[model samples]
Target: MATVEVDQDLCVGDQICASMEPEIYEMRDDGLAYVVDGMEEIDDDDLIAAAKDAADACPVDAIIVEE
Candidate 1:
């Protein structure tokens, strides 16, 4: 399992994370990306892959994954 973390300070509200991994990452009212439960339910490999991909693609490099 992977825990997703987003750095609000660096996030640019790009929505890339939400597009890449809807189940794992979401856009809050603040217009920033935040993980769902930090995406604790994302145990499937595909979902994890998408989440990781989103993290890697974040322009601000604000996502952090912990296994």
Candidate 2:
């Protein structure tokens, strides 16, 4: 499984992660990116890949994925 996290301090609210993976990420009213509830740890390969992609797409590299 992969553990995913979004660092609010590093997030620039670009929403790239949210755009790339809406099921796992969202941009809140605070202008920061966050991982949706219950999606912190991912076991599905497809979702893991999507999360990795979202992490890579983050301009500020706020997203972290640990396998």
Candidate 3:
């Protein structure tokens, strides 16, 4: 399984990650970041790809995945 995480300190409030992985990424009201995937863990390769694309698209480079 793969896991996605965001470093709020580095998030910069960008929504690119959200756009890239709407199933997993969202922005906080305070302009930080959060995982809204509605789950506590990642389960497969497709989820990992979506998370990776979101990470790659984030200008601030805040998203990360553990596989």
Give the best candidate by lDDT.
Answer: 2
The candidate with the higher lDDT, 1 or 2, is 2
The local distance difference test score of each candidate is 0.83, 0.93, 0.78
| Sort order, lDDT high to low | 2, 1, 3
- Looking at candidate 1, the ten consecutive residues that score lowest on lDDT are 37-46
Q: Rank candidates by TM-score, best first.
A: 2, 3, 1
* TM-score for all models, in order of appearance: 0.83, 0.96, 0.85
Predicted candidate 1 versus true structure: per-residue lDDT over 4-57, tens digit per residue: 788999999989889877888889999998888747545678877887898889
Q: Tell me which of candidates 1 and 2 scores higher on TM-score.
A: 2
| Candidate 3 least-lDDT 10 residues | 37-46
Per-candidate RMSD, Å: 1.7, 0.6, 1.5
| Model 2: per-residue Cα lDDT over 19-51, one tens digit each | 889999998889888899999999999999999
Q: After superposition, how far is residue 63 of candidate 3 from its true place, in Å?
A: 0.7
Best by TM-score: 2
Clashes of 2: 0
List model 3 lDDT by residue over 9-32, tens digit each. Answer: 888886787777778888779987
**What pairs collide in candidate 2?**
none
